[model samples]
Target chain A: MKTLIVVSHPEFQDSITQAFLKTSQAGLDDVTWHCLDEIYGSDPIDIQAERELLNGADRIIFQFPLYWYSAPASLKIWEDDVLSRAYTYASEEGHLKDKELGIVTSVGYPKSAFAAGASQSFSISQIMIPYEALAKQAGMKFMKPLVIAQFGYSTDEEKSQLLVDYQMYLTAKYPFSFNERETWMIQQLKKLASGNMKNHQQELDLIIQELETGQDDLNDLKEQINLIRNKEED
Target chain B: MKTLIVVSHPEFQDSITQAFLKTSQAGLDDVTWHCLDEIYGSDPIDIQAERELLNGADRIIFQFPLYWYSAPASLKIWEDDVLSRAYTYASEEGHLKDKELGIVTSVGYPKSAFAAGASQSFSISQIMIPYEALAKQAGMKFMKPLVIAQFGYSTDEEKSQLLVDYQMYLTAKYPFSFNERETWMIQQLKKLASGNMKNHQQELDLIIQELETGQDDLNDLKEQINLIRNKEED
Candidate 1:
């Protein structure tokens, strides 16, 4: 599916979090990255052009650094000038119907800080009710938010893992569960093994066997969880 | 107290709800009304000047129509340009510390639409977590949001009542409770009775008595509620 990422960071060039995330989606042909500041810096925003970009995408992701628990001013302006005017009531049915609305936001604080008794005192989902409400109003499906917390403190290994996970979140199958990912990996390995790749066939076979075993273990754990829940009910 | 109302409506002149609210506070001294669009119409925001205005205010109110469950884009831009750079980290203690942050917003839908199983499917307070989070980060006291829902359908009587309530919200005591308002009204009546107002002394006295009776009734209701809770525990 074609994906559009509308990035809204005041200092986009200076943001290490955004820069690193951008690198994660590198060489992805189906992804269109549009920076708000670069496109409409200090100028009157072209609403038509923005609507055109929205029309061309199957999935639209609002990517930004969380400023005071919301997007920076640039994104708000874009929403007012472009989205509200064009998408809300301009037509009989809204322009953004059936499209998937997603958010990929990075917060300065750790994820643990956002809880009832924690420093933030509210979960990310609670704070993002405005977006959910907007999605409802526009007839779009609100996808679960992808939250990246404490990007500055992440180790190199974690960053590498994040790159893989972020890519999967953007372009992988819908619902993007662990089961789907495992199945995809196994399919790819089988395809490679079928080819004249005799050098890595043994290693690929071993990895495929490990993945199948892991899936079985996961199913067994799920059954155990269900049994425990039923026991508690009783 | 000096009150700064930073209004972020795109078309303030044409907005009936905002215009009516503005008339409610007409000729009020110590209230600075700054229209964001009129101040910086498609121009680069003057961050220093905006900071100066914020510093002068005892209470800062963000007044706007709730677009997509938050303020209009102009306000967000003002926040990014003015507040974040200057107020958030200019000093060890933030510039907005101890000052009150208030929201005066109007929504298109009825208040009933915002509930668990309702059309909006979330409370206004939930949708306003971003503002609360901002206030917490800035060390400012986040005032209870003054939500005006379905302004287009409100009757003249409702509008008049809103005018009184909205004024009290902006300039009354710190908490702005019903009890404080009752006390303020009684005090005003007593002061008027003390003056050479021979014609309305009896009417004023009756009004003062009614207010006192209303306060007594409210206290009695609270006591009954507490007693019922204790009984339930027993």
Candidate 2:
């Protein structure tokens, strides 16, 4: 599926986290990275062009840093201008109907600080109601948000896992069941084995083989459990 | 109490609701009506001057029509440019500490549409978490929001009640206990009697006298109930 990442950062060049995220998806196919401030740059947004971008994407991602517990004004300006009621309402034209809407927000505060009694005193889910409501009005599926909290404090291993998670969020199927993840992982490994990692092709192939064998074993175990339960019922 | 109403409406001139609200608060004392779009039209916000206005007010009201379940972009721009972290954090300078933050938002939908299973499926309180969280960070008291819904559908009596409620929201004491509302009403009526409404002076005076008598009788009844409770304890 084609994914569009609509990024809004006032100081995009100065942000290391943004840079890392930009680079992470650079090699991914069918993913469009559209940065608002970079393109508009204080000019009025071209509503037709913006709507075209939304129309082309199967999955739309609003990616930004959490400014004042919401997106920066540029994104809001875009929302106010481009998302016309006639085009957005489910009972009307509904251009965004049945599409997936996702949010990727990075915050400076620790994840633990977002709770009823914590320093932030509000969960990310609570703060994202506006977007969810928008999704509802447009008849879009609201995907679970990917909150990158205190990314600077994350360890190298954690960052590696985040990279995987971020890529999966963009392209992985809905619900992201374990089997779906395994299939996506194997495909990525096969691409890597044949592409830039030609020297490590043998090792990557072995790993892919092991994953496929594990999947087979899992299916066999499920069948055995179902058969035993059926016999007990009889 | 001094009130600074920072209003942000892109189409302020065309909005009948905004016009009605503006006229409602026209003769009120110690209330500064600051319209952001009119004052700073296409101009950058003067951060220091905006901070000074906020600093001067005992109560700060963010008045706007709800666009896409949040305030318009201009208000968010003002917030990002004006409320710098150094001056806003309660642990730091905390310039807004102990002040009250209020929201005055007009919505197009019916009020009943903002419940879990309703068409909107999100309460105004849930949608306003960002502003509430901002108040929490600034150590300000977040007042209950004044939501004006379907103003065009309101009857003349409903509109009159809205005027009084809006005035009370801006000027009345916090918690707005019945006694406090009564005192505020008496004060406002007295002001009207002495000022522009002097043509109905006798009638207004009689009404004021009747209200006072009713208040005194209620107080006496409360005292009698307390005395009886004390005797029961004995």
Candidate 3:
């Protein structure tokens, strides 16, 4: 599937979180990153061109930092000028039918800050319901939002995990599962081992072994649970 | 209390809903109407001036036509530039503390279209939660939104009612109630009758009479219910 990420940030180059997220998907072939601020610098949006881009993508992701509990102004402008026209076309021509609509947002505050009696008083998911409603109106499937809370303070390990998760979020098939993610990782390691990267062989082997051990541990836990159920029945 | 209305519409002059709503509050002494599109006009926002306007108002109203389940892009841009800076000031100086935040939105579709299993699939209240969240963050009291659904197709009676409601929404004290609204309307009719509006004397008297009749009927119903309970006890 061709995935298009429409990024909206007031100062894209200055955003550390956005920069790190962009680097994670740098080598992907089927993914296209379109930055709104850069594309329409002081110019009116070309609605026809935007519609063409949307037509070519199977999965469309709206990526931004949460500003005032919603997307940046540029994205809203794009929706008003471009997406409004696109919706009209979709209604008549079924252009966006079966397309996947996804949101990948980064928030400055911790996730826990968003809840009843909390600082934000509403979850990120609640704030994002309008987008889900928009997706339904356009006959598109709304994907679960990928929320990165406190992006500026994320550890390297957390970012590494985000790299893998975000890539899968963009390209993985429908109803993505944990098992599919594990399989994909293993396949990637095997491909790397077969290539002429002899210097990294030892590191690759250790990583593969760890994955295998983790899988065995999960299977053992499942067996233990089954045995407990059998004993209870007897 | 001084009320500042920040109106956001891409095509403000061409919008019937916005025009009608604008007329509702015309000639009001303490109300300031700032139309974003007209103020900006392809130019960058003057953040300093916007901040001054926000500081001067006791109640700040965001009035707009719902585009893609949210406000127009201009509003988002305003939030990012002006509001973000104002929030910093609010944190330190408590500038927005004790202020009121209100939303007056016009939707293209009917109110019923926004519900579970409906075309929009999310109520206006749900969609406007972000604004409510923003108010909480800034230490402002969030007012219940004034939603105008299917604005173009509203009946004349509905439009007349909206005119009164919208005015009270802008100027009324905190915890605005039905009784306060009715009292205000009666006072206005009495004032009009006392003024040199001889032609409107009969019409104003008729309206005041109807309002008094409604109030009397409500009081009589309450008294009858109390009497029935006393008889039942006997």
Candidate 4:
């Protein structure tokens, strides 16, 4: 699908790293990069201009650093304006219902700091609920977030890996579905132990038993995860 | 202190309840309520104008309806534009170093869904880490969020009380600092279960025994409660 990247970094000119990524990203065909601040400047958004942009693109990716636990101010403003207009348009007569929504957020903290036992209290995706919800309201596919953690501490190799991972995230067909994730995890775990399910076989057997004996709960979990995963798409 | 309320509801007009709250919020003094989409009309923000707004205010409040798990789109835009500018400004010279930030959100889901193991795996504030981090980066105090749960389903009484509580939160002199919250909770709990320790000898002795033992994780519990309460504020 054709994609539009709504990049929201404030000082794009001074951002050597992000500018570098953008240069590579720009090289890709079938995608357009819009630096929101440059487009909007000081005036309010022209509803028509935004509607046109939304209508033209099949996927819209929100690109920014995860400031505070959310987006920068202009991105928020863009949501309040652009997305609302889309909703209004849809309510009147559906428009842009099949488009996809995504996020590319750069974070400063180490990945582990976001765990339950850590000082920060929640993982990165948990901190990204608001964007997930936005995708739902606007009727777009909520693509998994492309996260770059410890941006300040990254080694050159790590940074390069992050860039490649980000590109993969933006360009690839989604990795797996919510229902399929548990199975994927189980398979990966088995693969890691020399393709021997025997080591973790008891745990897998127990999980299978649980899935079979408690079909209702497992189904509920699957349904719930599906809802979360499909929110933006619906 | 003076406060700025940046409300991010997409359709403030059709929704009578939040709209009513907005109307009520209008007459309050020392608070600037920027109903973002209403003002910006999908246009970009004027950086100088916003800087002036922030420079003028003592506290900044991001007010919005909880969509899925976040503030509206425009609020994100605002953060991206305004705060990133402030970040660059601080990097180059310095600005917005001492301001305070808060969130006041209205959620459609009831409070039950936010618990651990609940359908949604995180609370409102847990989902809003980007903002908290931003406050830290901006060198601003991140106050407790003000949340109204199951807003559309809230009873008349619930909303009535919420209005008063919200007003108090906006004007209160006591900022919800982590340092003082545990002490505050103990004091509040004491008000409910026991007489003043100095006045009641036996109760005081029992409480003092527990206090000496230090068994209850009052501090950690207080932090969690504070997080939820603070989410309400934002």
Model 4: how far residue A83 lies from native, Å: 1.3
lDDT-wise, the better of 1 and 3 is 3
* Tens digits of lDDT, candidate 4, B1-234: 788887777787677656767766665669787777788866778877887888888888888877546677677667656665444333433466777788887766677877556545566667767677556556677887877776777788887788766765665555645434444444434543454445566675566456634535766777899999999999
Top candidate (lDDT):
2
- Selected candidate, larger lDDT, 2 vs 3: 2
Badly placed stretches (over 4 Å) of model 2 are A223-234, B223-234
* Shift in Å, residue A145, candidate 1: 1.6
Q: State candidate 4's TM-score.
A: 0.54
Q: Model 1 clash pairs?
A: A73-B76
Across B76-167, the per-residue lDDT of candidate 1 in tens digits comes to 87887787635574245488888899999998889999898877778988988988887877778989999998888999899878987887
DockQ scores for all predicted structures: 0.63, 0.86, 0.84, 0.26
- Give the per-residue lDDT digits (tens) of candidate 3, residues B106-168: 987788988988777898889998888888878889899999988778899999989988988
For model 4 the local lDDT of residue A197 reads: 53
Total backbone collisions for each predicted model: 1, 0, 0, 59
lDDT of 4 at B173: 55
Q: What is the lDDT of residue B35 in candidate 2?
A: 94
Candidate scoring better on DockQ of 3 and 4: 3
Best-to-worst order by TM-score is: 2, 3, 1, 4
In TM-score terms, candidate 1 sits at 0.84
Candidate 2, residues A76-186: lDDT per residue as tens digits?
Answer: 999999999998888799999999999999999988899999999999999999999999999999998999988889899989998998999999897788888998888
Q: Model 1: residues >4 Å from true position, as ranges?
A: A85-92, A186-234, B89-91, B187-234
